[model samples]
Target: MQPLPRHWATVRETVAFPNTQEYALTIHGASDLSLEDAQRDAQERMALLIASGGPGQLHDSGLEYYPLRRLPEELLEELRSPGGELIAAISRNRYGSAVLNTDALLISDVDLVEPSPQDRAKPAGGLLSRLFGGGRQAELTPEQQDPDAFGLPGLHRRGEHHERTLHLIEDFRARHPELGVRSYRTRNGFRLLVTGTGAGPSSKRARELMGQLRSDELYMILCRVHDSYRARLTPKPWRIEVDRFEDLGTRTSADETHHAWVARYRAASEDVAVCRLLDVSGPAPSAVEQQIIDLHDRAVRPESGLRLA
Candidate 1:
């Protein structure tokens, strides 16, 4: 009987982003293996990773597996993107050392065994799901929420269930210092944005945080004003009205100033017909913003001087 196929496996997995987790699994047998044996070896290796919780703390929910017979373009792009967010999955073959990166993992260059004539091995289904893992852990459930209800030094402890969130924010800030995160005041409350220089781990973490907040309804209400000037500005003759919340005076006391600004915006949104507040709170537009607006205006309303060049 021929010996089982040889498989090479990675023992080190690293995640360069805040919202990611990494796992490494070992594969056995590489002494004398065939093509089919090699495939089975890779499958078992991925199964170990899957059992460990996929790529990161978050399981790979959208990963798929394919035979190592051919490399697809999409898989190649995911593996090659310089600053891509996708996880780098690595695997190795036992024969000619054909490095393969299925949709969800990358196998670094390694030898792969060639199949001998009449030597046949069956294809294993569910390689992707097995390697990527399955299901999110229940450790983060509400019942298991952090015991420290009050976040930070002086924040209230009553019903404030965001200990994990606060930790994530602090970790992100510490990790990415160059970027500027502005928490602007509005009728609703605060709007936090992660912006700054290079593309690094912090930015990736910030994006993930933003995604989580956006999904929460509490954060949504604190982000918008009802009677904003943008909503009230009735473009005369055009029948278009803009009622954007006007940001008020700047103060040294961040908390007080934010609260005051929320009130002001709320009042403005409520009295759209009577209040004559101007739009002064728009975010300081960057060069990217200007270019985008210019392009959009030119495409939609060429008559307006909103378009440049």
Candidate 2:
């Protein structure tokens, strides 16, 4: 599994082309980049982009198995084990939600609905497809091909979706009796934390288990790219009736306006929960798993009686 970098830096520069068009570029580094190192890297990438005559900006492509190496999020907190090993990092996401990033634990986010045909039509490129290529569409089983195969009564009914999702979890538990599974009910689907089955998010075993559980494809790809699993720990801004933060990128500093927005967001989200504890099945979580579970429960307030957002 890839470890989270302790240092982060961003370099910005303006490049003037032969056409007299100047473009502003921003590059990020996470491997304890010094000022000189960042500038050199930025210049090298800028030259490549110029030679290729591509877009002036660097596109994340929503791909990369080691995105955290250049992750552009504001780090909020770090969760370390008693042995002083970093277990997780909480950061403010681009959408203003607090996200938990971890490499040690295997976390899966499974969506209830299947992707539309349009979504499947797009070519699977980037780091994810490069590493875990082929069978993009061929991997779908018969059950996965049918939208109503989950015993969902209606396509738009939330209650039916929730029930079907729970049934899926129960069936999975019955099939794999040796693995420990902690399931949570999310707004769109389910979040699962599994133990006694896999060790790290980057392992083949983790991918196989996620595939067996029908986890979200993009999420699975992200896990592979980041070499870690991520879960949202806070309610979405839209769900709480708050506008998204204006600046949504690698932040050098937080301003008064950002602080005020966070205050309002927290106040509005005070009564909402990100997920609710659905069930725990199969086996007991190990000591390490328990620590992660405790941290997740505390942040998400699974027993708060609040509606999931």
Best candidate (score: lDDT): 2
Residue 207, candidate 1: how far off, in angstroms? 4.7
For model 2, what is the error of residue 138's alpha carbon versus the real structure, in angstroms, after optimal superposition? 39
RMSD of 2: 10.4
Best by TM-score: 2
RMSD of each: 27.6, 10.4
User: Model 1: per-residue lDDT, tens digit, 1-309?
Assistant: 111223332223332444444434333322234546555555664555555455443244443221211211111111223344332222211111112222111001111122333322423222212222333222333322322222234322111223333333445456656544433211111223333332222234423444433323322221121100011111111111222212222222246754554454334333222111111222343443233223222222323322111
List model 2 lDDT by residue over 1-309, tens digit each: 344544555666676766547777565655434546555554565455655443423233432323323445667888878788778888777778889888767888877744446644656663224323443623434333333233334432333344456667788888889988888867667889887876577678888888877887778777777777899999889888998864533254456677788889999988888887867877887776777778888999987867778
State, as a TM-score between 0 and 1, how close model 1 is to the true structure: 0.20
Count: clashes, candidate 1: 27
In angstroms, the error of model 1 at 129 is 45
The per-candidate count of clashes, in order, stands at 27, 4
